[model samples]
Target: MSQLPKASLKLFPCTIGGEINYSIPEGVKMEILECRNFIVENERTARRFLKALDRNFPLEETQMSLLNKHSREQEIPLMLKALEQGNDVGILSESGCPAVGDPGALVVAMAHKKGYQVKPFTGPSSFLLALMASGLNGQQFAFHGYLPVQENEKIKSLKYLENESKAKNQTQLFMETPYRNIKFLAFILKTLNPSTFLCVASNLSCEDEYVRTMTVQDWRKTELPDIHKKPTVFLLQS
Candidate 1:
């Protein structure tokens, strides 16, 4: 009997919100050069990221596939076809680590089910960075991707999260679209209790990185930082 060949699925983490060359590790760059097939959230950014990782990268010879919110469930398995062919496949998100708060999770799950080796590389993660700087209860925390968009629904959800945090002493973390960050912060400040502590981490790992923790009352008193149209993470603890 002939032995079957094996290939690994590599999960590469890009910069959370900083210069790729400054943030990406040399090991990750070397591993990226080893794989020619990649499943990315955005092909354009992934290409740019690869190019930034190494100017000598052979982009023309690489195979790039999209796996984002618009990706269908049926199309995911096909994305892993490269792995079955004894070729290592890489996964990259628009920013930060793939699969965490990103759609790459779907393919990662499928990769595991197919018995392929799934390897994750270390890199910047906005939520984790925020949590570390939050001065909140790191031991007890939960990440709720996003809240409802509707005003009433969002307010209800905020109140619920605040109550849950107070009861469990867990830090609650979430995010919003860059463009809506200002509005979201305003809403959070207005909705959460005055005594509740809120931490806003913006432009993480970047030149303009900002991370501040304060009570809702203190935040109200101080002038808001210019987080408009910037990637940010919001954390609350009561």
Candidate 2:
């Protein structure tokens, strides 16, 4: 195979939540096989995903540069250096699209700043999937990664998002730490207006995936699921 010229960085998105074999596509698998260098959130997670795509792929041969929360500060320098060497690289997040809610954004921005191309591949995204099934204003929506950990701040932010959704006729989307899902749901039910619409999407792309939209009033009557420790996305629109 002839050496390909210096090309755009590939942003490969893995499934948000599910079995990799069923969720990942052949094209994505090909992309994974093509790249020998990658900037991943976690080397172990990336290796496992690549193995799921192809059991025989040489995991030890691939060069992976970590870009998680702890290593983020040092990643750009290394990633840029690799790109400058005319090597095509892939950015892999633990779940969903790289840089969407992940730490890979900084590297992507640097790639753009250096005038290097950055290409995003097709894949699952919890927020987009949730918005599609949300029955809310997808045309105008926002994704606030995580809510405040404190009770008072969480309530205040919920009220603002609810009001913003109602007044501007836009969808307001957000997420919480898996363990905090139940508590977050409770806060949404308590803070938002009774008429406001709320959508809870959990374990997306998984066998037990759940995405439901309902009014705050109606949600009060419905029993909350055990979303603890499950990847979940929440949306609100009035």
Candidate 3:
């Protein structure tokens, strides 16, 4: 059999989402895999995580190169190729676990549908973290991936979510592209009632992490740090 250049995939969470970034000590020689590729947004979370693991590239590349016209057209193909090549992979996220508002969802989803073993090693998930922190409720929380992009659709969805939150007392978790987090906050302010409690779990499990629980009215006055491009998770409790 011919020997192939070794490559591996690893999924580590953003700095705010897991302990993998902070656990690596000074000099620990462990090179079981030939190559490692990390997929994450361009920000502190991703950078710090890699730094802690002491990954140097050409040594490590990002999956962003697979994006085709803002769509991950090549994600599945590349992942399949890697898996087929006998490379043990790690599919990581900028925040939370991989496949949850992260780049590796398509690949993981496909892996499952195709009868592949999809074993997962997870860290903190902002959705569950927020639910655990919020006093409103936790027994029943619905993780709504993201708000609708269209204006009218967003409005309608917000109204429905608000009512559902009120009736069920279930936490509703949502997020936006970190840069547009403020825009999503503004939308919440404009759509939800003033008294509704909103929890903005930005940079979870990190030094500058903020788990602020306040109402829409308070959010209006509170000087929130420009969490733009940061790994942010937003939650609403009515």
Candidate 4:
């Protein structure tokens, strides 16, 4: 008799901020307890999250495969092999939801191509959270991920996103390196129209969480918060 295939890979979402502040669902916890094979962005963070969920859980014995921006393409075969052998696998990211604004997306794509089922659990997502509170056009929004590193190129991209927003009434969303958040904010205030609506959601879900939407002109007048080295999401509505 042939062995039946195991259930689909579980795409688990970790906390964007402090795990203590946002609890993982009990259903996901039970799922974790039943999964031994996992593909994670960072083994250390994944293990830490699992331990936090259940202190008595044995992490050392679990089989872990690291997947990150630098992950090798060859690693996909091994992970798929584990799944083909009737073993359910878990995909995790360092923070927030996996496969969304994360490198784990590559693995998830491969799973789909190979006819593996994927199950995603509900969790905190900074992008969606910021949009929900942005008071912008959430129905029509586009996330441009990280802005260009070069100032000139970045400015050009920003201008394009701004004009596109005006033309289509779309909400333009993007992010920057935490350390460069203040600088990026400064650039936005200087480049975009003063009346443009901007939302800066920083340190989401944390005690020091800040989510403010205001006109670029108003933002320039207010005292800017210290967002250096912090996770932030930016949104604009023209």
Per-residue lDDT of candidate 3, residues 132-165 (tens digit)? 7666577788888777888899889888878898
lDDT of 1 by residue, 33-71 (tens): 778999999999998888878788999999999998989
True-structure lDDT of candidate 4: 0.87
TM-score against truth, every candidate: 0.96, 0.94, 0.68, 0.96
Off by over 4 Å in 4: 20-23
The candidate with the higher lDDT, 2 or 3, is: 2
Q: In candidate 3, residue 105 scores what lDDT? A: 69
Off by over 4 Å in 1: 1-5
lDDT on C-alpha atoms for all candidate structures: 0.91, 0.86, 0.63, 0.87
lDDT of 4 at 133: 85
> lDDT of model 1 at residue 87?
88
Query: In candidate 3, which residue pairs clash?
Result: 9-89, 9-90, 10-90
Against the true structure, candidate 3 reaches a TM-score of: 0.68
> Which lDDT tens digits does candidate 4 get at residues 88-111?
899888988899998888888888
Give the best candidate by lDDT: 1
- Indicate the worst ten consecutive residues by lDDT in candidate 2: 71-80
User: By TM-score, how accurate is candidate 4?
Assistant: 0.96
Candidate 3 RMSD to the real structure: 5.1
Q: After superposition, how far is residue 116 of candidate 2 from its true place, in Å?
A: 1.1
